[model samples]
Target: MYKDLDEFITEYQHTADFWYDVGCVMASEKLSKFGSEDWQELSSIVHNRPLEWQKKLAYCLDTSCNMYELEILLSLLNTEDEELFEICIDTLRSFTTQESKQMILDNPSILNRVNDLLPKAGIVSKKMLEDFLKKLNA
Candidate 1:
């Protein structure tokens, strides 16, 4: 688990250090989000994967996250934490890449879940999600 998103991104991008390598990922809060491996305690604490760190994951959702990070990303959509929620929204909206659009299109559950959350979203977030959904559906 990362202390914040930058560290998560840094580690994933391979900009951390040459030493931080192979340990694809680790889940947040000491829980195994993906169950890939026992990420070394120090490395996970120091850094973790390599594209946006596996193509910069948030940007590569369509390329790399389809099977692994999708659930984590989806879970973040409901967070009340302002910072995290913002990152989630920003990362989600960045899915405008053609492949990312297809990622959402391929997963109807993404739409369904977003729709389900509409009634619960705050005014600002609601509007953002609405526009996001519209673009994807369009």
Candidate 2:
């Protein structure tokens, strides 16, 4: 278990296991403190990492991120990588707030892709996507 934020940064910065360990630490009982800088750093990491690392970090960010961080996740919807696109959509489903839904709706490409892909991926029911689209258009 990590003792504190600095310890986590000092030990885990720049490693293959960084995100996985960060996720574990975030989920653990240690109660790591995250400031704006920490969140920004994590967001940068998410944006810069490869698809696999982004996938792993997405799981961590999903649980810990704020709305701004969530927008970072939403941006991943534009990725041409099929697996990453699916993961972003699945993660976005949990964020049902108006802002998130609007973000999805505002992006025609993302909205169309969600309509196209969700059915094939089976991440969400077709009816649910239809309802969501209805809400967006309303």
Candidate 3:
């Protein structure tokens, strides 16, 4: 769907409401087997882009996306870009399952932010909280 990660990231960064249903579908397809190559490519997109551009890409991550694309979004979230972290925290809150919550909590950098924001988003179970804490401790 995308010529390359840079081209795709650039488009998403510059386009408004870029993460439409069609975009999500394409992202899902591309990320079905997201691995080292894809991660390196996406990370390069984040590494080279400016903060504002990365912020827009983060907004694209906030869309209604399938699990595969969400995982790719999470991979992008691993970037040290603070803007991406902020947007990812918000996106994680939008998901209503322990699986999504657990995924967010697995990242130490985002865990506290997600926990702080989750209450406003909705309630999370005690077991989920314990598991997340355990994951961090481990």
Candidate 4:
């Protein structure tokens, strides 16, 4: 749809009510696909950009969050970047059980990635993730 992730961001990242829709479509088209130009390029945007973009990128993970992406998302809590950490927790906190189950089923082999993170996560991060996993079990 656009030349690169930045171009897509320029085109779609905005205050419109449709940003989530844009994010959902982008996740389906790009974030879920490993090694595609858009996929490979996402980490740079998340780290190098300002808070808005990072927060918006987190929104993209709101749906169809694969294990590969989830690993990175979970890793954000280990960062000193408060903005990144809060958005990371917020994103995980917002997930419903249906979404959690679907994500686990879709990426069953990587379920341990989430489990393994529990013990190493920071106190707040661990608490949030624990509540999250409980929903997964429910």
Candidate 5:
């Protein structure tokens, strides 16, 4: 429908209330995972009812979602990549112990690439990557 994550975020930033209904749809289609404690825990802080709500939410979550499943869910911003939806499953398969830095080290080369770009990225970017690394180290 939306076409891409960027598009979804953009649209949501403009009108996130739509997501209330979309969330309902997701619920109906068994998308309740988006409402789970993990999701709700994070959503509680980010889900603000404002014109810029979704953008802020995306920013907050993007920074905070260090775990693989949460990282994968961020891609939901991408609207057309239905196949990309498996990010969560793939992340789960590559699960890491909450107490192991090996998880970050164990991540595929691609995540390394993502990390590599961190220092040069903006504040949020650097913070997000750093947070992920922190979790791994924790």
Candidate 6:
């Protein structure tokens, strides 16, 4: 694994597989040292990377992500790529706290889009989808 954060930053930051590798590492490690700067770096990678890379990173984030990272995951909902959008939505399902729910409902359009897209994605259970919709409508 990564020896330390600085080493990871210096050596992997500009590599072609940065996001993919970082995502895997994040999913597997607590990496609690990550602060706003690290989140920004990860977010930047997710925002700037190719669709395939984005999908891989989204999957990794889905496996394990914190509240601070929710916005990055939410931003991915805007993608037109179906696979990426589905992976993003699946990742988003993990953030079920009141704050996360409210943050999502704050963007009515994105919430509505989630309502529209969930069925097409066909990844979430019917009950879970219903609960999410109820929370959004509430």
Best by lDDT: 6
TM-score of each: 0.41, 0.62, 0.46, 0.50, 0.34, 0.64
After superposition, the stretches of candidate 5 with alpha carbons farther than 4 Å from their true spots are 1-30, 33-105
lDDT of 6: 0.62
- True-vs-predicted CA distance for residue 128, candidate 4, Å: 9.1
Q: Residue by residue across 15-103, what tens digits does model 2's lDDT show?
A: 54655565445533232355566656665655565576566545444554357547777766668887777666555656667776776
- Candidate 2 ranges beyond 4 A from true positions: 1-32, 122-138
- Across residues 1-138, which tens digit of lDDT does each residue of candidate 3 receive? 333544655566424454543554455455454565665566555646776555555555544544544575676666665546656544544465567656656666666654654465434443444444455445
Candidate 2 lDDT for residue 117: 64
Q: Point out where model 6 deviates above 4 Å.
A: 1-27, 30-33, 62-65, 118-138
Error of 6 at 124 (Å): 5.9
The model with the greater lDDT, 2 or 5, is 2
lDDT of 4 by residue, 1-138 (tens): 213545566566466467765554764465544454444456545566666666566656654555545655654545556556556655765555575566544654334555766788889777876876676667
lDDT of 6 by residue, 1-138 (tens): 213533443334445466555645654453456666777767666666667656655655643357656777788878888778766666676777788878887878776766676666544544556665775455
Clash totals for all candidate models: 9, 0, 0, 0, 7, 0
Model 5, 1-138: lDDT tens per residue? 112322344454324455544532432233223434545444444323342433323333322234523543443333233223222222222334563235445556535554655657667556655655555555
The per-model lDDT (C-alpha) reads: 0.48, 0.59, 0.54, 0.58, 0.39, 0.62
Candidates ranked by TM-score: 6, 2, 4, 3, 1, 5
- Give lDDT: candidate 4, residue 80: 59
Model 2 lDDT, full chain set: 0.59
Q: Residue 127 in model 5: shift from native, Å? A: 0.5
Better of 2 and 3 by TM-score: 2
Model 1, residue 137: displacement in angstroms? Answer: 2.4
Among these predictions, the greatest TM-score belongs to 6
Error of 3 at 107 (Å): 2.8
Worst 10 residues of 1 by lDDT: 22-31
Q: Order the numbered candidates by lDDT, best leading.
A: 6, 2, 4, 3, 1, 5
